[model samples]
Target: MSTFGDFFKVTTYGESHCRSVGCIVDGVPPGMELTEEDIQPQMTRRRPGQSALTTPRNEMDTVEIQSGTEFGITLGTPIAMVVRNKDQRPKDYGNSTMDMYPRPSHADWTYLEKYGVKASSGGGRSSARETIGRVAASAIAEKYLKLSHGIEIVAWTSSVGGIHMFPPTATHPTPSTNPAFLSLIDTITREKVDEFVPVRCPDQAASDRMAEEIAAFRDKSDSIGGTVTCVIRNVPSGLGEPCFDKIEAMLAHAMLSIPASKGFEIGSGFGGCEVPGSIHNDPFILAPEVPPLETGATRNGIPRPRLTTKTNNSGGIQGGITNGAHIYFKVGFKPPATIGQAQNTATYDGDASGTLEAKGRHDPCVVPRAVPIVEAMAALVVVDALMAQQSRQVSRSMLPPLKTNKPEIKAMVEDGP
Candidate 1:
């Protein structure tokens, strides 16, 4: 059940305070160059203790490649990656309070009820530590997408505790719909986003405000939640299926899977709801082709679609398929539940009441750290959809290449099943 993706699957293992947390990644393209170097940047960003806003717990969170490569190239096999837990405080959840009483808004109660027993250390499978596997696995998917289609995914903190980067007049009616913000879709890069670390919102003034808000909450022994906006660029049109696996649906599915995510929305999301039908629609116009760079789209000779939209209110997708425009979306995260503030709650026996004082390292505001995670999940969804779309395109061609063209390439794709 921990597995994700249809074609490019990842099954994660281990838990917080466990010996190690890792994943088994399947369906990577063969002959692709991969290494820990490609994966470490995102892992480092997701790691805690980088700044005052994040949790104080410190670990290198370094990734080790266990299998699925030879001479630094993928062999078209299941890739296994692991990150050992250097800091384990299982005793923090000792038999006293955490073991007897379910922390409010945490997974403690639900997990115990479901399994009849649960890991007292952290929230077991529900901890944010579980996402280390996802972030690592997505790095591979990102490489493949970038090499194959020139795709780039970048996400950043958009709002933290209501300290938003958007203009003041902007309202929920235009959630991330600022024409200026949307214009940054292709231009924003990870380096630019990370420039304002601890609160990765791109706007300097807004970032400062968000940072201050997080500090206020931290001082109060509480936590705050925030939103992340992500954009996917250079995705070939016509990825994603009808009825079931819409690109937006897949994106939402992947984003919502992160530990604290509470809501998911695609371009013009709830905001578009208030606009008139004529104003909300994206009008199609003929597209112009641009020559690929040496590092760009691996020149598979697949012709780019000749049409695009005057506006991207559809968020690069129409119905279920992509329209070759950049896809953008926002994810909402709830406040971290295990705040250190003292609270009165009942015990497991439902008998006597008690005061609980939460302990452990937790981010006051998780939005900054969530940026890499959002990008990683976006990479997974795009790569999986890219594989599906390519297979379908090959199948539908008027002249079948399977019989006469590029036998070696065909063999490589065929090896999966």
Candidate 2:
């Protein structure tokens, strides 16, 4: 099914070349404040033609809310949002030869066999444009998660082509305990953003090399792909369901839905496969203190245990559930398939051809635009998890009420400086 989530169902519709593309959110709680502006920034981030590295197809990608909101607040009805498609160049794909000679590494061949017909222009529903609705819907979900639960999600390119950069390891010590500590964290995150500007690498020299490689590849009329790492911090434990709809499973489902995504791993991911169980396991430790006496919870209550594993070999997930640790994961993308180099192919009528060259604007690498898409999908997954957790049949009295003073969450709502 194109729809996802058990508690908060999101159905995306329309095609790349269609009149418009949009999404329908079925289970957003009533009284949540939402607006078209809240979702536009995300669409702008994923829209093509934003920079030199992406396709030249320019789309305004302005979102329009059709229903489910009254005076900027949700009404507990299905929320529908649409983005009109502009700058479509159907003539660019006039050659019917694609009917027989499918683009290598694309869904053309399989889609034809499965559906008997496909959109001739821009790969139709399979186009990256399909992600517009997803990003828009996810923007609303993100706002809700932040405003209601203080959960924040962010993603960035960890590697391009084959270059990899180490993320910052110094945890922001209690920001409230010292104002200077908070400033330090903010400075580091900003520096990291700047260091990664050329290639999203924290290592300056490595980033420079990566930029050189990207420029060289662009000159060669070829494209490449790389890895995207996402971090979801301040996620409360127990958000994921047991048995079928586990957190990681749902996250994988959402991430794989992105265009050009081929592989997925959480926490340690594939790297952990080489380590033994002893090395991969996360050890639990008791919290120093617990809820206040007025809150009626013991300071050492249940140990308030945390996964203190020195290494995150399991990717912050244990027993198919979140363990209140930062959830980290990586996604792999293959090079963009539309290259300028000529290749052997056939005509639409099945006639053989010697060499065919593609004629259209395309990215040398899709990782940059994909970074926000990854973050958006992750936000959707976590928000849906929170929805599921909140909607559980259990009584609220059995669990501690959510805390609103989470400081790490504030960083998520504010844009990167």
Candidate 3:
């Protein structure tokens, strides 16, 4: 269960309080340039103590390459990396109320029920620290996706508690129908997102409001939840697997796997349900001809779809497959459960109830730090789906051509629908 993907497999190891926490990444294409420097940026973004909105745990989160590369070139082997836990405070959770009662809405209760044993500090594998491996491994995938396909994945904090970056109104009830929202997704970059740090929302007004909201909660010893919106551009069409592994379905699985994440929505998502079929339908229009890349490399010489939707209510996916348009989604994180407030709960034995005041370093709002994790997971899903689709295309190319006699079918096949 620690590993994910069929082609680009990643097996993460270690725990929150372990000496080191990292991952083993397999299926990297040989001869690609990679190194610790290429991975450290994302790790730093996901690291704690970046700002006042996050946990104050001072972890540099410096990454080290253990294997699978020589002189910065990938050997197509398993790449191993590690990050030492420098500021571990296991004693914070030891010899206190934690031993008697499980924190409400925290993983402490379910983990004990599942494994019958819990880690000495934090949530063990369930901790946000475990996401270090995912962020590292997905950075590698992001590099590959960028170099080979010109794909770009970017995520930013879009909401805090109930305050949204782009609130729906009578004029624009859905973001897909708003040109401003569409333009933002198309042009927003990581640098712009980071410029408004602490909350990571690009809009200055929204970022300020979100930051104030988080600070208010932190002062109260409470926590709040928010949403992160992600956009993937220049992605090739026909990337997702059918039946079970739809692109959106896999994305949901990946996003929900992150600590504190509670909900996932793609494109119009739940909002589309209110619109009628006539308005919700994405009518196809001719896509502009894009010039070839400077590298002259594309996903098997397939540029992009000849046709695209006039209105992308479908979110660049049709019937679970990417449709060569920018794919966008939002992930909702639940308020961090491990607050500093005292609460009445039954002990592990369920015999007695008492107030348990939890003490430890935890984020008042996780959306800012969660930005990189969301992008990382998005990159993982895109890379895995791209590889799977490429494998099928390569295999299908080697087969004999069909000898059918139906003119309509043959013409459609020859011309490409």
C-alpha lDDT values of all predictions: 0.86, 0.72, 0.89
TM-score-sorted candidate list, best first:
3, 1, 2
lDDT of 1 by residue, 1-417 (tens): 899988999999998999999999999989999999999999999998899889888878999999999989999999999999998788878857776688888888888789898887888999999999999999999999988878999999999987777643545366445667767886999999989887989899999999999999999999999999999999887689888898888988998999999999887887888878787788887776654432222224444336688877788889889978999999999999989998888888885568788888888878888899999999999999988977775665544334325767754532121
Candidate 1 TM-score to native: 0.91
lDDT comparing candidate 1 with the true structure: 0.86
Best by lDDT: 3
Would you estimate the TM-scores of all the predictions? 0.91, 0.83, 0.95
Better lDDT candidate (1, 3): 3
Model 3: weakest 10-residue lDDT segment is 292-301
Which residues of candidate 2, in runs, are more than 4 Å off?
A: 167-203, 288-311, 346-354, 393-417
What is the C-alpha lDDT profile of model 3 across 1-417, one tens digit per residue?
999999999999888888999999999999999988899999988999998889999999999989999999999989999999999999988976788888888888899889989997887998999999999999999999999999999999989998898887766677888898999999999999999997999999989999999999999999999999999999987789988999999999999999899998899887777778899899988876754433233232354336777889888898999988999999999999989989998888885658899988999999999999999999999999999987887786677755537776554443211
Candidate 3 C-alpha RMSD relative to the actual structure: 3.0
Candidate 2 C-alpha error for residue 298, in Å: 7.0
Per candidate, the number of residue pairs that clash is 0, 3, 0
Better of 1 and 2 by TM-score: 1
Point out the higher-scoring one by lDDT: 1 or 2: 1
